[model samples]
Target: MHIVVCIKQVPDSAQIRVHPVTNTIMRQGVPAIVNPYDLFALEEALRLKDKFGGKVTMLCMGPPQAEDALKKCISFGADDAVLVTDRSFAGADTLATSYALAAAIRQIGKEQKVDIVFTGKQTIDGDTAQVGPGIAKRLGLQLLTYVSRIADLDLEKDTITVERRAEGGVQVLQTAVPCLITMLEGTNEMRFAPLENMIHAARYPVRKWNKEAAGIEDVTKIGLKGSPTVVSKVFGPTPRAEKALMQSVEDATPRDVSLNVIQKIFTQHPTLERDILAKASV
Candidate 1:
């Protein structure tokens, strides 16, 4: 069971800044951490690898600094880490991201068949859950998003059963292997890396791949050129209308406020008073 977990390095939301010229996220200076949701997927992959007695590999596509995120996964018990970084991969949206990830997985498959691929439900910056499904579609893998728990695993049958989160409740679905599963948040706690694991991560030689190295032959298919959607503008949050006015009464009795509110309402709409009086019993 060789499981591949796809993780991402994201800017700490509290430290995020937008570039004035490009209107893009200013990633420099701000510290980056593994996408919070990816931790759930990584932990689940590690747990499954522990039970099944196989290897787990962590993969990510981001700037060169993203190697830190891959190393962190090594600290959490992943056997190998692959970092795909290149200027060609910059400015990638979900569609382009999925294309690159699926390509990397294909290259990995050439070495050994991957049993499963794992991804987080969404990223804080993107907040779009489309990438996982896009990857699944490209790879022809079964797409399982918002999975809450692994109900059962049958190695012999090459099948996995999981409880998926839905609008009202959970849905139990059984799917074959070589599938992609996106773990839901708060499903499982991430394991703390021990002293030995931490040391291993510090010493691990992370594999880096450039555009050609990651097997990207088409220049237009790996970055913004490959993305279908374009964000025209990014704006600050809009303020809501309506304001609250509190009376300065010392007691602030409900009766007084209610009467005052009624007066104000009737003053705005005089017919409201007639309608309310007609409807009232007394």
Candidate 2:
């Protein structure tokens, strides 16, 4: 079982700031961390590799600085890491990003037959949730998104079963090998790296491929040219002027305080009483 896990290095959203004049993200001072959702995919891939005794390759398409994120994956027991970086890949949207990734995966498949590809449901910076499906379309791979659990794998039969998180409940679906899976968040916990693996990861030389080296032949199919969507503006949510009113019940009993709080809420939102009554009647 050869598994490829796609990951991204994203700015820590908690530290992100919006520029006052340009209304753009101020990434200058923000720290870069691996996307949290991708961690779940990586952990799931690692678990499969551990059980199957196969290789797990970490792949990422980002700037040169993104190699740091791939190194983190190496520390977690991934057998190899590949970083696809080039200036032409700048300002790429989901379509171009998926195209480049699919080409690179084809290159990786040349060296070792790839059985599965794993990705996060979405990237925090983009949050479009289109890249995984795009890659599947480009590669003609069966796509399973929002996967909550990998139930079974039959390497001998070349099939896999997974529990997908759907609206209201879970869906159990089976698919063949050479498929793409977008893991759901909170599906699994990331494992801690051992001291030996950490030391090796610190010294590991990750493979870096340029646009041409990664098998991108069409110049127009990558980078800003291939990206049709453009971000016209980025703005933060406006701050509300009024603050919430604090209700104190130091002298009242718990029951009285609860009633008072409920009354206050109903008074603030006049429709709440009617809404509650409607639900109760139903």
Candidate 3:
């Protein structure tokens, strides 16, 4: 029942700023923090470890600074932490990232049989929601996304049931071991690290793996060369020149205000009323 939880260190989006001239993200003064969504995944994994009494490993692929993020997970009670960092893995998109991470997971599997892999539903910076599924496809593991809860687990039978949040309701699905799950945010809260754990995390020797160590043989399959998606440009939304028109309800009755709003809408968009009537007739 060994669980591997993947996390990423990302810039605090609240403090992120865009360059005025280049329109690129200004990361110079921004503080880095663990991806919020990944915290839920970590907490869920920790919960399972508390119940099942198995090891939980934290994995991340980023620059050397990302080791801090792994240490943070260690303080939260993960048994081990692995940092896969190499210059060759720089500028990787979701595809290349998944390839590197999948390769690294294969290497980790050699040391210990990984029963389950957990990740966040999406990264805040990218928000593509593709890496988890990509890793699952690359590793041929069962894919579960938007998981709200772990309903049941039977170690003897190698079966696990989970509650997945779907469009309208939750779907309870069971799958075998060696599966990948992308946990939905707000499903669980991260626990506070005890003083001993914090001290241990600070002194823990985080295992560092480069591309060669992470089992990446093909140089072309990682980093920028493997990334197919290209951003043509990045720009902020155009600012509106006119301010919104304000309706004063202080001097008007509710009925009068309602009529005034509808009248204004029709007045501004002359064809809106006609279009509504036309659609209603159909």
Model 3, range 97-214, lDDT digits (tens) per residue?
9999999999999999999999999988889899999999999999999999999989999999999999999999999988999999999889999999999999999999999999
Candidate 1 lDDT over residue span 86-149, tens digit each: 9988889888999999898888888779999999999987899988999999999998999999
Please report, as a residue range, the 10-residue window in candidate 1 with the lowest summed lDDT. 236-245
Q: What TM-scores do the predictions have?
A: 0.84, 0.86, 0.87
Which candidate model has the greater TM-score, 1 or 2? 2
Candidate 3 error regions (>4 Å): 239-266, 270-282
Off by over 4 Å in 1: 17-29, 238-282
lDDT of 1: 0.90
lDDT of all predictions: 0.90, 0.93, 0.93
- Best-performing candidate as measured by TM-score: 3
Which residue segments of model 2 deviate by more than 4 Å?
20-22, 237-282
Count backbone overlaps in model 3: 0
The per-residue C-alpha lDDT of model 2 at residue 199 equals 94
Inter-residue clash pairs, candidate 3 = none
Give the candidates in order of TM-score, highest first: 3, 2, 1
